[model samples]
Target: MNLGTYLTRSARYWPDETVLVCGERTWSYRQLDCRTNQLAAALIGRGLRPGDAVASLAWNRGELVETEFALYKAGLMRAPVNARLGRGEITHILRYAPVRVLVFDAAHREDALAAIAAAGTDCLPVPLDDVPGDDVPGDDAPSDEIPAAGPVGVPYADLLAEGTGDPVAVEVDEDEPCVLNFTSGSTGALKAAVQTFGNRLANMRKQLMSDESRPRPGTRYLACGPITHATGMGLLAGVFGGSTTHVLPAWSPEAFLETVEKERITATFLVPAMLTMVLAHPGAADRDLSSLTSLRIGGAPIAPQRLREAVALFGPIVAQGYGLGETTSVVAGLTGQDIARAVTEDPELLQSCGRAAYDTEIRVVDEAGRELGPREVGEVIVRGPDCVREYWQEPELSAETFKDGWVHTGDLAWMREDGYLFLVDRKKDMIISGGFNIYCTEVEAALYEHPAVREACVVGVPDERWGEAVKAVVVTHEGRAVTPGELIEFCAGRLDRYKKPRSVEFVPELPHNRNGKLDRKAVREPYWADAARRVN
Candidate 1:
């Protein structure tokens, strides 16, 4: 079945139910269904054929949601660019994906134009200022000139208005390409993970079956991060269950809390960094967040102690998930109940990302592909319907990462006797000091336990005697003071002396990548510049 059918099904089952809420605008199932149909017909009318690539560079908005459904209906491949990406990365994706139509939010007009010029492609540019049922953003008075069709791009409203407003009936096989999900190019060049229609369907099923963060009727799932990332993976699940998906146009700790209270948001997804910020926000304690039932955090490994703190502040409703872009949404998840158990009973389980999700098989394998036993740390590998088959066009990388029908997640972890998976650190990020392996995540988690530390990132620096020395970069909480010696002493209590950071550098804030994960590569780049080899 076409994934787009989920939206149509919701419209038929509950026509008046709200499926989307962006800012002041709300979209009912019926309205969203018809608009997407119109959009599909309109894109077809503009000479786009099935299998053509359509790229969208926009923030979280009603139009972006409509366009995704339209792509599924039209059988076009979706290439969603991160709005924060610079012209260079944007151009690379544009040319590599060979997008036939490029759509952008008015806010990104300049960047889109520049990328288009750089890529030198014949891609059509469409700037969306307003869509049907969308509120115009401006002062009490009217806004400035709205650009239409000439050098800039065509207005989305004009295209939608010209279409027949009927559903575009197209045959899309379940295995057909659906989304070209781009990986965060933190380690190297950007690559697109080719997610198929069947893979997405599997994602929907996994999300629905999950106990902790499942979406149900009237479930209000709020997304503070850009929906183009992991946060947007829940869109189809929302439609399937007759739930409403709320999007924050911008992100701020105070603003996010305000939305949860104002909208009575029942569930939401945030990266660990965002979770830290929200908990530290002055207004977080004062906000009325009792309505939130599921607080799902992912995109990075959060400190177990920090997760316990979040549960304390937000009730026992915090859930943690672990997955990569290659594995659609989440293949393993720590349920809210699991979190509650960790806080009250088994604090050790807090480090595990729960058991494998429904229908997903997880394995820890050594270098020779032999599965390891309990408490034995090795590379984590997973296989399931939700996992991607290959990277978009990179055959070599596809073979390397997707070996033997399994997606070899470079994360080093070990499974417990009871089947819980405990992540150590990224294989490449593991540091060896004096022949002792030290996981950076372990160190960071220790730093988070200190009350004065707001955020922490640990890396290995070049050293003579130790070969590679453990170094820590930290961001302390506001109005809190802590010295390097104090933080090192704190780590000494939780970890081995060799694993403790030999030196610590305090900064006002840590750098986060476009996807909100701490930019460890960026933080470590300067230190390695003068070294002959990054690793000792």
Candidate 2:
């Protein structure tokens, strides 16, 4: 069935139920459905067809969600661009995707128009601010919302309001593409991973049935991250199960905590960096978070100490989800049981992402693609219904990514005897020193155990003597101090001599990509600028 049908079905069953909440505005399922239908008719009138692409450059807001449903209803593939990107980067994506229609919020109007002009693509800009924000109440006057300063061609409200005809019926195959999500190119250039309706449905089913995955009816979910990313798309799991989504336009430690208490949010997903900021916030101690049922975190590994502190502050509902854009959001999730296991049996287990989800087959394979046994490190390969079949318009890359029947994750990992999978590092991120392979994650994990270290990232730098040398970038706890010698000594006690970092650099925070994953490439680029290639 088409994904649009999911919204229609839900609307029919629970017409008056709150479907979306942003600030003070709330939209019932029926109201949302009608708006999407009107927007879909408008899109069709504008010449959008099945398989045509429509892109949105916006944050997590009510209008963004409305555009998604409208695109689905119109049978157009939705491509939500990362608003953080500059004009050049945005232009490249528009040129690559060749979308027919582009939507932009006031905040990103300049970049969107610049991208459209640079790409020379036929794109109609739909200003988001002019759209009605009259669902519930509480925010500033809606009349004050002006068209974001750019080439304002059409107002989204005008288009929706002008189209008063009945919604057109569009037939969509289950295998038909629904969304196009771009990968955060931390290691290489970004590629669009096309996700199908069937893939999303399968992923949602796995999450809902998982022993640790549960969201009560009318649960409030605060979306503070970029909705254009996989983590944002994963919020559909909450929507499918009947939960209200509260959107935070941007990430702010103070605002995030305040929203949680004010909205009585039951669940929210955050990256490790965001979590660190929330914990560091001055008001965090006074915030009432008893209503939170789950604090979902992923995109990077969490330090054991940080995990402990999060549990201490928010109870045991901390959930870790493991996946990529290619996995359509979640491949494996560390549930409450998994967190409890980490607290009791082996805290180190918390460092490892939980076992593969039901319906997913995970295998660690050697360089020749030979399957490895438990405790043996190799590239993690996943074969599941949720896995993307191919990258958009890149047949050669698709072949390299998908081999036999499993999708090569390019991530190095090992499985324990208990069936838990431990991520070591990205294969590209692995540092080779003196012909010895050292996984950055292993070294980072060891460094994170230090009392003074709040966050750590490891990368390899060029060394004339050793061919490559390990380097550590650390973020120390507030008011705490640690010298480079002390950090090296700390790692020496936990890691092998060669595996330990040869140099340590203390920084306030490590650089992160748009998706919130540690940008090892950015961290190592300066040191490897004169080298032949960034990696060995």
Steric clash count of candidate 2: 0
Per-residue error for 173 in candidate 1, Å, reads 1.5
Name the regions of candidate 1 deviating beyond 4 angstroms.
130-151, 185-187
- lDDT (tens digit, per residue) of candidate 2 on 1-536: 55666677777877899978776678988888888889898889888888888888876678888888787778788888876666677888888885888887765666777778789988887777643422212212224234444557687788788565365457788688878878754446668888887787787777777655554466887888876665566456665677677888657898898899988988888999899888878779899999898788888777777777788789899988788878886777678767866887887787788888889988899999898999999999998988888888889888999787688998999999978889988888888889998988888878877888878888899888788999998889899888999999889999898898889988877888777777778888899888975554
TM-score for all models, in order of appearance:
0.95, 0.93
Q: Which pairs clash in the backbone of model 1?
A: none
- Residue 49 miss distance in model 2 (angstroms): 1.0
Best by TM-score: 1
Q: Distance from true position, residue 330, model 2, in Å?
A: 1.0
Candidate 2 C-alpha error for residue 444, in Å: 1.0
